[model samples]
Target: MTRSSNAPLSVVLAGGGSAGHVSPLLAIAHAIKATVPEAAIVAVGTKDGLETRLVPAAGFELAFIDRIPFPRRPSLDLLKLPMRMSRAIATAKSILRDANADVLVGVGGYVCTPMYLAAKSLGVPIVIHEANTKAGLANKVGARYTTFVGTAFAATQIRHAHLVGMPMRKAVATLDRAAERAAARERLGLDADRPTLIVTGGSLGALRINKAVAASLEALAAAGIQTLHITGKGKAVETASGELLTAPLYQQREYVDGMEDVYAAADLLLCRSGAGTVSEVAAVGLPAVFVPLPIGNGEQARNAAELVAAGAALLVDDASLDAAWIAENVIPLCKDDLRLATMGESAKHLGIRDAAESMAAMVLAASGK
Candidate 1:
């Protein structure tokens, strides 16, 4: 790797087809900046993904690469994979050269493959951070040339992987439970005395989680439980709000700027089991019912199982997520104060709050910062 005397310790962070990938990269970027104040970080992503908006908003520069979707079924996209990959590699290499990045970190996404290959060609020491229990294809390929690999799950298949857990945003890391609860409730105009359930399906929102929770709004209200739902953007929040408006104690929101308060105010969580979500829930010591996304590599299922086995959370299949089932088996947990506390305590046992620090240290080691 070439380094200039005047340049700061530079890093190229790759990955971002979805929020699942982008959020962790941002978290890591923040951590690196916090730990090594002079470090210069640049994100490598496509123009299409959330990173285009999120990276800049996070106060980092993002360099664009050609779009390269992970091949699913056989189609024209698969046929064009070779050309797309070639262009992506070229784009990544140019960005690396332009930025004078000292090290490359790949956060598992299809866009990462080319970035990793380009970095390897430049003889830059590479690190891969896989946020799922199962390694994504990009991370799996990136791992072969990488000196260090980190994962949210200890059980990830990549060799030489460090079980550092998922890196959470600094905002999440700094949450104060009691203060968060009061502030979150007051901000949302929710009653502080009532039991509150917070339901979310990641940043983009989960349609299945939204539908099931929306259908159960009446039941939740009847059971004397208040609700805070974060539907993904583009979802019809008005439609969901209209359904909840018919009930006595329900709130529907498209998004919240301060998620820490949401976690703080929540008596329980109903959501999907993305790695970042799992880490945040556990970090905040919140009890949850996890419904893993049915698609992808079953990583969400694996993440949920780890918590479920620890008695930190409950796992419900998406197929069985009707209102009746949630009401019958899940709703009662909201009423059990002792059980909720116990679950929260257990969840805290699964949290690695220092994950960001560990990841930052790893990056520093890889980059010789």
Candidate 2:
């Protein structure tokens, strides 16, 4: 294990529940290390979710707290929320004392509520990073005590919110497009001359997007467009395809670890409009057809609208996502080089690649480091 200097400044990162929250936390942690080489960093999250595996892989110590999902409707879980929250706060106090953290950063989730509260009680500085266009329930409550607020969306509900944008990992944000495209296609054994379409449904994959693309496969192939599909865990490309168009035209996998390659090799993308997805697409300058996940009060749809208004992408409502519409609207964009190039250029202009560094600087200032 690597050790920092005695009396080194310490920070505790608290968040989880999805990759959307955890990935940005990881990016800020990386930026902190780069900017303040002597700083000590640790993570706080539940035992469940991707954080259990991801935090350790990123070479940071992780402290697990009690799991708490925000109650959608009042129930036994809601009744137990107060008790669980008390216990989680106590756990956070113990972890904070052990790590000797001088400041706490909440990345937005139920796990963050207790940690932020504990930090407030201890008189340690607290900061929050909100990734949604509208504030999430956890962040909204935590914002009252937070010293600084940062967000991917420019106009969020947080009172002191700053438009920092979402922070992507250094590897993905700084990938060389020309080199990555060549290497990624070579690795996937795809044709260099053909226009390629890359489709993904985020980390867990979207059933709606998957099914629509599967139904439109014949039409896409007929238009001479090859594809690279990341199907998550639910569906498989082998099961979706019979025997035709196997080689040099189609590549499918449950997940693509090489996202840089996926972005580089694709002429266009069909994806969900989550904060992380939108930010990455903007940073990479890719033309995309966004199908927002229709949940809650249509927050994803709102996010998609922001990009479409900026000419960065095209939005397709989840209710209207059929094979015919997919073929008609999305296939043409892939085939039309001039339109594709224009959209890609507009998308790239929306990226704020320095967001992580800006957020880290705020954390440092708040900590009086």
Candidate 3:
């Protein structure tokens, strides 16, 4: 019944689909390795998620699980839920038994439900991490079975939640923008001395945000600011004449591989207020103008709530984000170094630099290590 104290900890982590889930999962795994060098770590994900690529790339063994999407309303999928859950639970039991799993960690995804169920049956301790202000269904179900639940946001509504902040990559957690700004700017072909602004809507980009940035390009350039706009795949900004918009003092890319570099080089950021973006920006102490995506139950707004309240960031509605708004708000803010520094300091004060280590310690404790 007790985890073997002499044995290396065997941990099974479940949660994957988007970068939001996978990125923190990887960060936690790395932190666990840092703490217990000989710990055996395995990730549970679906065959089609970003985890399929990211998990192995991070040098962890990834176990595939059936994707069981929860039905929001009455549907055929809901009718077959019993049989599907039974099969997935059986699969999860097999995975845990084979890995000799001492503890199961769920990070709020579809893959986590079955893992939580299986772990509960096997008497394996469960640790849950909810990354959003509002808990997801999977985490809600997982939370009922264990008390070691951690949250990225203090406002997150989870059972027995402890504030552990967001587990972010070490690159971002350890970044010193002041020390790396010049080199990062040089690498991106930006002027080292000039104020730089970056606009990103994450991997797939945000069309409305891209368009708004495009419309305000002239104003930003006129303010002696350089821009790096990552316009997601196939969502390129075009000119009035129907060609790709390639203006001077502005750079555009479909995506950038290493975002930490962009974070380091930028003087200001204009981005959507996803949990990952909010956490990373705060961790790097990057002053930002967050345009909370005007969708999905206002969780994005909630994610930026603490930072905005602390004067570390501004939250603009998606509809209010236009050329004029950018000109009036972002342009002026980007040029005010004293204000930016103060905001950055406020953000750093709120950012949790050791969340991964904290979560890792939580995992080790639950494993009886």
Candidate 4:
């Protein structure tokens, strides 16, 4: 049952819709291919999802399937739901068969559901990775078909789940922040000795976090702490008039392409507590103040709970995050070197740096390779 190094096993990773799902899919795929260069790696996604751009960019073949959203309430879309799902499943089954996939990996999204069902019908080994603390619908259903479920968070409520951590890209998982600090700081025009904090709301931006943090730049500057504020997309940088707006101490951007370098230079992070964010921060051992998004299944809060409990991070309510709160809590933490260092160490201890390799091993085992 073993494949030689020259003829590696094939893997089809199914998940899309958002970066959260696609990120881990690529990470695992990258891990598999890196370990076995001859492996044929393919990504299953819809034409409209983020995967269309991301999968191919990562050097994997992108296979298309029609997106099938399970309609919630009764409507025209609901009436069409069954047919849509059937088509998607048929498309997935065809993709699986054509690829001669040895294993189908689901990363828990709407796109994954169809692939999971198709994999089961085709008698292909199925492996699932759940990133959130609360299991998504796709993972919940996929779990029943196999016991080889991997989870980012230890407490993620997925049946047959084992803690394999979030599979992050090699650039992130193997980063040596301290070693890269000088060059990383220089890249951002930041002083290596100055306290640096990174405030991000996870790509789309958080209006409240932007406003609150933007308002506190003066206090942060006065405390000798510089900040890299990722104002999300299209948000105006609303710092106080005059010098503060153009100060080198406060850098603002809509997005950062080189996030690993940013993580390397940062001393503290103020951001939302999404599963991927939590895992990435923990992997880098960055001390953070997590602000869970007000909406959703309360999963964001649950995602940060273990880290907070481990003294690695602090969680703040969305409603309570204001300029005054940042001054009171965040600014002081920036000045406290010992506290940040201790928290960073604690966070690193809880992180799983080898998750990509571990998850790849799981996939190979399940495939009986």
Candidate 5:
């Protein structure tokens, strides 16, 4: 790897397709800057990925590469894969050369596949962060090129994986629910004295979760549990107008810009078990009922496994998360203060609050900074 004299350490972080990959890359970028104030951090992503907006908004310089996905199955697309991949790698290599990056950090995504190959071609040091228990293809391939590997889940079996935990944003990593409960409840229009259940289907809204929770709203409300449901964009959940609305025990919001308040006010969480979601909830010490998405390599279930084993979370299948399940399981769980508190403590114990700092240190060490 080439090192420039009299220049601050230059890092080119590559990943993006969804928030799952981009969020950790941004978290690490922030951590690197915090550790070395003069460090130059550049983000590399495809034009169509979420990073197009998220990276720029995070105040990082973004470099684009062509989007060329690996051919998973034989098709006409497979015949053209080689040429497309070559172009992507060339574009990524140009960016790394232009930035004179000392190291290339990759999180799992289609973009990172080419970025890792490009960095390897240039003899630059490579570091990869795998955020799922079942490692993604990009990270799996990238792991072969580097000894410095970070992982969100302890069970991830990468070649040299270190359990650095998920790099959480400051708001989530250090949040104390008890300290901010009153004001957080006031801001979210939730009852301060009552038990609150926060049901989320992520930003896109899970149809199963939305439908099931809506069907179970009455039972939850009857159990004296208030609900704040984030119905994502384009989701419309119908609730009865009289007592529920007047009492405002069931609050449905499309989105919350400040999620810290929502976390503080929540006593129980009901959501999908994506890697980021699992890590964030665990980091904040929130007891959750995780409903793994019934798609995508079963990584969501694997992501929640450790938490479930640690008594921090309960796993439910997507098909089983209906009204009856909520009434039989969630309603009683919400009312049991001792159980909820115990689970919350278990979640906190399993989380790593300084993961970003640990990842930053790994990057620095790999770069010989």
Candidate 6:
């Protein structure tokens, strides 16, 4: 609202808590910089959130505000909500003013609620990107005040929503998996000529996935497949007898920075179906078996629904993802070269590669500068 049409734009982006929120938020920031080289991009987040580390690392100025979470049930915390919200909104207002924010872009988190309310009161243009198939409470509240809304999935129930897909880091958005495969395999120490599966349970790891993969490792090795199993920080797949379970063809890694190498080296991805993971995997055309975490209103399952229906990915219940399921479904899928190729093609067809640019344009347009 402060910038004129010919002047460089100033944008405030708010999203925090999880990497799911921060990843897409950073992608949008990168896109905005690409389009408007002089644009002032200020990211607002709680000090306690991942943004403290991630935003500064990504070369953006980060501002902090108090987090005011909505209570789910009747409690004394609910009674104290107004005072907390007021303080957070006041802090958000200061950040917007300091940045001369013409537009406030929110990817939805506890940080966004205060920022959205502050932006509404200050008459700054609001643009929102909801990443989940089912909108979160913070984004739902934001949608009520802003017509400029974009979503990762088609079925997100926000008023005047645009299905612009998830914003991806430029590296991931433009990845050429087939072309990068050889070097990527080399980088990950994977066999370049062998069929490969990458199983990642994310940073905190999935106990069910790690256990199942550990149990099925011998079978995977017999079928001539190599695996890069990411067990998360300080966690690993262990035997029932409390022994570290590993195989010769199986590699255990704690994490992969940037994720491009892992994606390129993978013939198939076995992971959870969080919105960011689903969007990234589909965009990269990696055939996948999605194990949606069975929590939070079943949104993860919904996030994977489109790809699963397209045969780009397969979905299985979290409870059903055991050794038998991996052997019966995953091993056979990994062994089928023709099927993997088919699924990769299907995934590529459904992916929107330009989402970062598109979302950037949407936010810029809403700035009215």
Each prediction's TM-score against the native? Answer: 0.93, 0.94, 0.97, 0.95, 0.95, 0.96
lDDT of candidates 1 onward, in order: 0.84, 0.83, 0.91, 0.88, 0.88, 0.90
Model 2 Cα lDDT, one tens digit per residue, 1-369? 123458467989999878988999999999998998778898988888789999999998888899777687989999998898899889988888877887888888878888888888998898889998889887887789865999898867787898998888887788666668877887876788788899998888888887777778888888898988888875664453453224346667888886778888888989989989888888888888998888877778776666798888999888798898978888888989899888988988887787888889888988988
Kindly list the per-residue Cα lDDT of model 4 for residues 151-199, writing each as its tens digit.
9999988899899999998999999989998999898778889999889
Instruction: Tell me the tens digit of each residue's lDDT in model 6 across 342-361.
Output: 99999998888788888889
Tens-digit lDDT track for model 5 on 186-269? Answer: 999888899899989887888899888878777888889999989888775754552222224787887887777887998899
lDDT score at residue 254, model 5, on the 0-100 scale: 78
> Between candidates 2 and 3, which one is better according to lDDT?
3
lDDT of 3 by residue, 1-369 (tens): 223455499999999999999999999999999999888889999999999999999999999889998888999999999899999999999999888898999998999999999999999999999999989999999999988998998889889999998999998899999899999888888998888999999876898899899998889889999999989888889888989998779999898888889999998999999999999899899999998888889999999999999999998999989999998899999999999999999999988888899999999889887
RMSD of 5: 2.7
Model 2 alpha-carbon miss at residue 50, Å: 0.6
Model 2 Cα displacement at 2 (Å)? 13
Specify the highest-lDDT model's number.
Answer: 3
* Candidate 2 segments whose C-alpha is farther than 4 A from its true place: 1-7, 237-248
> By how many angstroms RMSD does model 6 differ from the true structure?
2.1
Tens digit per residue, CA lDDT, model 1, 158-189: 87888998888887877767667887789878
Q: Model 1, which residues run further than 4 Å from truth?
A: 1-5, 70-75, 237-245
Cα deviation of 212, candidate 4, in Å? 0.4
